[model samples]
Target: MEIQLVGITVLWLFLYGYLIVASVDFGAGFFAYYGKITKQDHIINKLISRYLSPVWEVTNVFFVFFFVGIVGFFPDTAYYFGTALLVPGSISLVLLAIRGSFYAFNNYGAKDNNIYMFLYGATGLLIPASLSTALTISEGGFIEKRGDKLVFLAKELFTNPYSWSVVILAIVSVLFISASFLTYYADRAEDQKALELLRGFALFWSLPTILASFLVFVTLRQHNFIHFENIIVRYWWMFVLSLFCFIIASFLIWMRRNYGTAFIFVLFQFFFAFFGYGASHLPYLLYPYVTIYSGYTNETMGIALVIAFILGLLLLIPSIILLMRLFLFDADYVKGKK
Candidate 1:
């Protein structure tokens, strides 16, 4: 394979890692707060807390790698996206900081302030919505190059249906992914009450997730017809497989059997859908502006970065597996006996 292809594939892998890990983290935050409001926190919050305690600190590792890798691999992205992303990027950073602060406050400081919890839940949805601006802008029309200065059209972005569709999809997908994994976690914990609640959550969010995905497709056709055509023409099979995985996952969850296996199918669903969307969007990191070939880093740097990230992923996955074996899935630890 070409060096650029290898480099981008590595970067995309890092990003995919962030999507799954962060979705669970973010969804847990929202559910934590929701449980508090519903007076159901007594039953579910402990389960959520146990999961977050071990995992939250490391949740951003994948994102950090992907963010750094993007600029490292595609130098031109900074030139195009840097100016356009100022507001959204700043918002994402602030929200992320707030999320981190919530962990500090919840774990080390005060136990539960409604205000703090509210922020936690709100940012869970908002952070992804803000960060999605990069993808929305890449569809073009949201930014214009005027002479040497690039102008990010805030009005256009706000009014665009496609932008909102992506944002909605982000929010719903987070909830669905998080709920599905938590359902499995709850089952592992053998907490029937929490399992029932989270299963309801998983099933409820599944519809919206699928619906939002279709909305994205419809709006993408309107917003970036060329990319939509690429998806339908060349990459349709991946999305069909993604849908099949979604059905299997929801079915198993609905049947209340093989929760672990159901969650695996959920992972597969997103793997196919996320990569399908990404693969279809490719060659252009930012449509009409930066592409893999036009803006890639030098060959030596690209090769080094790919090797470093592949090594990073290799190390990261094992570390997470060890964590699961030691804490998350451990009979004693998972049951709150440890």
Candidate 2:
């Protein structure tokens, strides 16, 4: 009925598209590793690397562009939207970059070069540091109100809670980076002893990242952290559900022999995350900052959503068909493997 409502609906539908693509791709990757598919079958690796991986990567790029375009259209809303997206988007980007770098290193035999290894390790650390800094600034801890203007003083910025969050994030980031390096070195050595050590490091260090993310969400909710009351009301339940799903999925992943089971669990995790995010931020393109009613008010936008929803179903139906074909007819690829 209104422009803001229509815009919010379209944005959320786009996000659903993104979640579908991302979950499938991420599930495929997890199965590839869990099933040791790469070692057993080149076809499986090729399917993942050539098809699924690119799909996720392209989708991620589109996600970035989609938000960037929205912000461009509504400059006044950019700060709030950017603040909300900074932490999660940056985490995904950095993790994907590290994974991509690892793929390149393996493909090109950069493992033998100590300089290359050093650079890779340094890049990994830098990703987290840069993200932490961005998240801190985006959280608005340094801004001082001076009658319709926000000013940042260096001294205030340094002493803010955002700064402290950055420090904590940085510490966790280093742990993760170190874990990655350890795993890389272990792989290069091909020594069972080294691999075991690295695996332990990875498992231990990974927990902190998860914990930190949970803490952030918890604090956000406790403080009524973000703007927009409706988002807080609807999505708070979803976040709670997501935390439960994460714990359950992590346990299932540890115990399950069938990699497909673990893959499914991971998809559920993503689905929960998507639902929480979308539901919480509904009726507003950007929470705490911009609302749908304020941005645009055209019936055309509503019609567009109806049309897009139909198109989404069309696309989704075909994907289900293809997935069924793979599940039933392509048994050779997954059977006894998971």
Candidate 3:
């Protein structure tokens, strides 16, 4: 009900947007390359390329909005997370640059460069792995404030079990989310070959996604008991629903029916879990460092930001849907009739 809560909820929605869109973009790159190596490129690469061509340019818009909004709405995050995120943030940026170069090179320069494809595929996984550090660091053990300086324990982060677990989850979740959506997208395209291939990918990653989730929860109990307790007591229902959605999604995918419906369930699966984790971690943007109450901007600025982001969301969601209608889901375009 408070401005801070509302602000974060909106930001969380943006981040969720980034998660789904970018996962599809990222996993498409990996699948694109995987299809190549597996000698199945002729089967699904066109489908992947079609999905990426229009959507890739906009995938990061959600992320850019979230990054700016977090700092705008919670200025304290800048000081607390800035230094702590330096290396991981830089790694992600570099990976992003490499991934972007693939777009340019594949489009104009070298359409079939193996080196470029490798970078494209590698960054697909690497970016998410590096970015997941923010969530891991957020569980609140890797940063220290001493005297007048804020220190980031890079070694501690690398060595942390929960950190690795979260990274693993991010990679598998990216693949899972991407494959699920792409399966449906392939089905929409009526490319039975691609649909079967992507459906198999979706099913393969399903169990690993759930397992990685449990590993994070188990590791959370030891890594940050307070947040873990919050998860158990306050937000367990969200996770339960997440699991249920996963079950429905997996069953449908396995049954090879209603691909679109299955992917929607996959989205809900993560929506419940993601927001639930976020809701339980409420108040604190970074444990022991920044709370939404303590970190929020002043009321006037906060209201301005909230409205701006809401408008941005309103614009973004419709733009994507319209894009789908115009290009992605167009009867001609999707089926290669055009």
Error of 2 at 265 (Å): 2.6
> Per-residue lDDT tens digits of candidate 3, residues 295-316?
8899999999999999999999
1 or 2, greater by TM-score: 1
Off-target runs (Cα >4 Å) in candidate 3 are: none
Give the TM-score of each candidate. 0.99, 0.53, 0.99
lDDT of all predictions, in order shown?
0.93, 0.47, 0.94
RMSD vs true structure, all candidates: 0.8, 8.5, 0.7
Better of 2 and 3 by lDDT: 3
Mind giving the per-residue lDDT tens digits that candidate 1 earns over 175-252? Answer: 999999999999999999999999999999999999999999999999999999999999999999999999999999
- Candidate 2 to native Cα RMSD, angstroms: 8.5
Model 2, residue 149: C-alpha shift (Å): 5.4
